[model samples]
Target: MKFSTNELLPLVSRLDQLLRTAEIGDYPGAFNGLQIENQGVVSRIVAAVDACEAVILQAAREPGTLLLVHHGLFWSGAQPIKGILYRKLKAALDGDLALYSSHLPLDLHPSLGNNVLLAKSLGLTGLKPSLELKGQSVGVMGKIKPMKREKFEALLCKSVGGRVHLAPGGPETIASVLVVTGGAGGEVARAADLKVDAFVTGEGPHWSFTAAEELGLNLFYGGHYATEVFGVKALARWLSEGTGLPWSFLDHPSGL
Candidate 1:
């Protein structure tokens, strides 16, 4: 049975509720819902890690696809609709496409979030929250037994499937490491607070390198796009299984 946009709204909201209960994002953060809607009839769906121009173009070509993304437009909250942004929105409006996004909530979800899922995929145990963001933990810290730094790096490289930059902090044998997916390397100091041996994340700032050096915590950069793709794909799988909408991933390669 086909589900109209209005019919699917509650289902989407239910899915969002699940994600929110799991602590997907800051929760209080803005732009967590349906950002744009069309004529209220959605036939096909496109799920991507980021809602970029390319993904929007793909959605446009799909005619009635509802674009579900991890990162939505208007991150800065408000911006003049002109240039590229204007073009993207025009494309969606002209094609009658709808847009929905989930950010930090999708990152920390235990079953389908980027950090926890990556921890599970790597067979990490004793997963706990990071110490950085008080009142809430946005990343997962865990134990990895004792392994050589090179071997651990090899594992991460294989898991992420790209060039990984490793900054070994302390001993060659690592007992515990922290995992935070996508642009979270800046929180490596949180690993120091927990006394973790290594930290794995998508990308980090220049200060992250210096901080890891001083803290004696190994740092690994797994390429933000590569690390973040899994969670949305997992979400798409859940949507297919739960709502029987038959979802497919719109793989838009992001080189960042």
Candidate 2:
């Protein structure tokens, strides 16, 4: 089923308001909302984590498709639109592929956001927002049955469907699990204040390891790309349900 971009615009706009993308702070490259305009007709919607060269080129192959992604192109600010970047743009435009990106907004969404989805996936109930970033609560804090750290780590691995890296930095009996999917290891200390026993996120830098230990927070480094898949899939499902357009996920994990 084909759907017009105009029909999807209101939904997208409502999502912007719901996510407070404009009110919230994000990278300039985030450029939330519609980054690429197509021929007003979108037949199939493809959801992915990033719009890298490979994903863009793949989208170009399927002309007239809308590529909904979490991290859109242009993270590095403006360039002359030449070389590989130019080819990316040309491929997208020439293929009539439209791109829409959501960064912090997607991460912080209450219902369909990545944090909430990740938390729910872990069977976490009674969730509360935590770890505010850029004036938004992109991280989630929740309770469990107070299992051992090892068991909790195993459950978390099951939740994200990826191997989890544990620092074993905090207490053995973990009562709470805080999740901020995607490269949030830098904020390990932030979890300390939330009173959670463990912190779950995508990948983080090396310093975060010692920091997690010093901060006495259990750190679980789930793959960044793996943890971030929730939001795009949720948004795409919502869009497909609302618009009657078929959708599929282009899951190309970076495995970071």
Candidate 3:
């Protein structure tokens, strides 16, 4: 099956509105839209957390594929398009791949976002948006039935499908949790201000452990790559269900 690239315009417009891509403030390098165009047609959709060279090359295996990702190319800012960068672009162009990226926009999306999906997976209730970044609430705070901190950690570990680093700074029992997936560990202080019993995030700076302890906040560090995979997968599934386009996820873990 194939779809004209023009057929993607409506889908892209719907995504832009659904994610509020234009309204949301993100890193200048996010470039949160269609970063590259295909040869005016789409054959399949590929979703991944990052648009690294390996994933791009994998997408290139199928010509006319739409590569959807959370982290786009060019996070490090402009540089001479040579070496790995050059190879990546060449592969995409050669394979007629279209690349679309959504960083903060996808992270904060209410129903289909990384934070919300993870929160739901953890069986959280009373979820509300929290943790402002760039003038938008990029995380979720919610209630979990009080449980022993160790049990809570185990549940989180299962949900994220990896080992979790815990700074057990809060009480023995945990009832409330604030979740901001992917590298938001620096927001420990802000989460502390929210007075939630625990904060769950991807990786953070080294000092975040001490800060969590001092601030009386339990911290769970699920791997950054693990926690962030939800949004892209959810988005791809959504697009497939809506548009009847086949989609696949490219798993490239950066075990950070």
Candidate 4:
């Protein structure tokens, strides 16, 4: 089914509504909206985790690809279209693609959102909003019945469809795990302060591993794109259900 840009805007607006209801993001990342317009009409939709240079190149292949992403372009200062930046811009413009992005807005959605999905996958119960970030509660921190760290990592791997990179710390049996999807490893210090049994997120810097060891906290690195793919896929399913739009998820993997 084809939808004009105007027709699809409502469907897209519903997506934003769901995200607003779901997200728990703080103010660190900004400008989570339609970053670019390529075509007046949108026929095929592509949902991915990031709007990076490589993903941009991939989207360029489809003429008028309406790329929906968890991470939007131009989050930082605007730079001149030169070098790699030039390539990314040129590809999107040349493809006549429109880019729509939702960051923290996508993470905390109740149903069909990253945090909720992840939490449910791990059998987390009584999940409710706990922490706030960037004037918005973008992350979900809740209680879960104690489980083994290995079992928790296995669930993460199965849910995200990736190999688990686990830095096992603390006890074999964990009572509560703190989960922040999509590169929230930098929050390790905060998780440590909370003294959770295990902390799970996507990607980690050099220091995070050390800190996890020092603090005796279990750490799971489940690839950034892999972990975040849940939200967009859920959003796409939601759009399909709500608007009857034939949406497709562009299964792109970033082995980061």
Candidate 5:
């Protein structure tokens, strides 16, 4: 099956009010939708967590493919088209591969978002939105079956498919956990204020270490790259279902 590359715009527009890419202040580099344009047609979709050089090079092998990613090509923002960045652009241009990104948008989407999937993976019940930013809740908070912190951390590690960083500050028995996937360790203090027993995120600053201990909130760091893969996979799958176009995920873990 194939779809016009333009079709994705209308399909994803329904999510504008929900993802709020325009309103949410993400890293200036996360330019969101359609970072690169293709030759107006897409027969295959490749979803990945980042648009790193390796992923770009790989996608270039499959000409005219559309690559859907979370992290995009502008971390350094715009620069003279030279060096490695030049190579990435040249590869996409050569391959006719389009790149589309969704950062906070992917994180907060209700049906196919990162936070919701992670929360569901942990068997959280009565999940409610939390960690509001830019007038949107990008995370979920909810009750987990009461259990030891060690056990809950183990479950989280399984859910994220990576080893987890646990700062044991709260009680041994976890009553609730709040999930904000990817670089949200700093939110532990806020999670503490909400009376949750545990907080889960990808990575955080070193200062967050002190905050978690001081606030007595169980902090779990489930590698930033690992936690965020959920959204891209979910999104590409949805597009496949809707368009009948084959979709694949290019897994390249940063191991951060």
Candidate 6:
């Protein structure tokens, strides 16, 4: 089954409003809405974290496929569209693959966002928006039944499906957590200021470790890629259910 871009506009528009794609501020490169257009129609949807060459080629394999991503192309800003960039664009144009990206918007989405999903995966309650970035709350803070630090770390490791680096700076028992998926480790000071028992985020700089220790905040680094897969997957599933258009997630992990 195929759907025209016009038919999909309402759904996409609804998402833009729900996610505040236009109102919310994002990095200039985020270019949050539809980035690439196809030949006016779509047959299947492919969701992935980054719009890298491999993922673009994969989506291109299926003509009229809309590639949904968190980090879209053009991160490097205005440069000659040659080499890898040229190849990616060529593949999409040749194969009729459309592309759409949502960065901060997807991260802060109330239900189908990375931060909220990650918090939910760890069974956190009393979830509330936190961590302002460009006047938008891009992180979530929530309460967890107080548990031993080790037990909480174990649960976090399980949630992200990989190794977790823990800075055991907080109390032996953890009762609350702040989640900001993807490279928010630099926000250790901000999380500490929030006074949450712990802070969960993707990779951070080396100093963040000592800072967490100094600030007495439990910090968990759960790999940027691993923690961010939630938004795209959830968005894809929601779209499929709402529009009856089949979709698939392209697993391309960047072990950071």
**Every model's TM-score:** 0.90, 0.93, 0.95, 0.85, 0.92, 0.95
Candidate maximizing lDDT: 3
In model 5, the runs with Cα more than 4 Å from the true position are 1-20, 75-77
lDDT string, candidate 1, 163-202, tens digits: 7898777678887878888888877776677787888888
How do the residues 106-171 of candidate 5 rate in per-residue lDDT, one tens digit apiece? Answer: 898877999999899899999888987767787999998799888898898899887988888889
Clash totals for all candidate models? 4, 0, 0, 10, 0, 0
Pairs with steric clashes in candidate 2: none
Pairs that collide in candidate 6 are: none
The model with the greatest TM-score is: 3
Q: Which residue ranges in model 4 land beyond 4 Å of their true spot? A: 1-8, 21-29
Residues 15-81, candidate 4: write the lDDT tens digits: 5665663344434436676777765666667788878888888777877567888887676666677
48-119: candidate 2 lDDT, tens digit per residue: 999888898887788668888998876766668789878788888999888889888888888988899988
lDDT of 6: 0.88
lDDT of 3 by residue, 1-256 (tens): 2223336566677678878989998876658888888776666888999999999999999887889999888676677889988999999999888898999999999888999999999999999999887788989999999999999999999998888999988888999999999999998999999999999999999999999999999999998999999999998888777667899999999988
lDDT of 4: 0.74
lDDT of 3 at 154: 92
| TM-score leaderboard ranking | 3, 6, 2, 5, 1, 4
Poorest 10 consecutive residues of model 3 by lDDT? 1-10
Give lDDT tens digits, candidate 6, residues 53-165.
98999899988787889999866567798898899999999999989899998998899999999999999999999988887788999999999999998998899998899
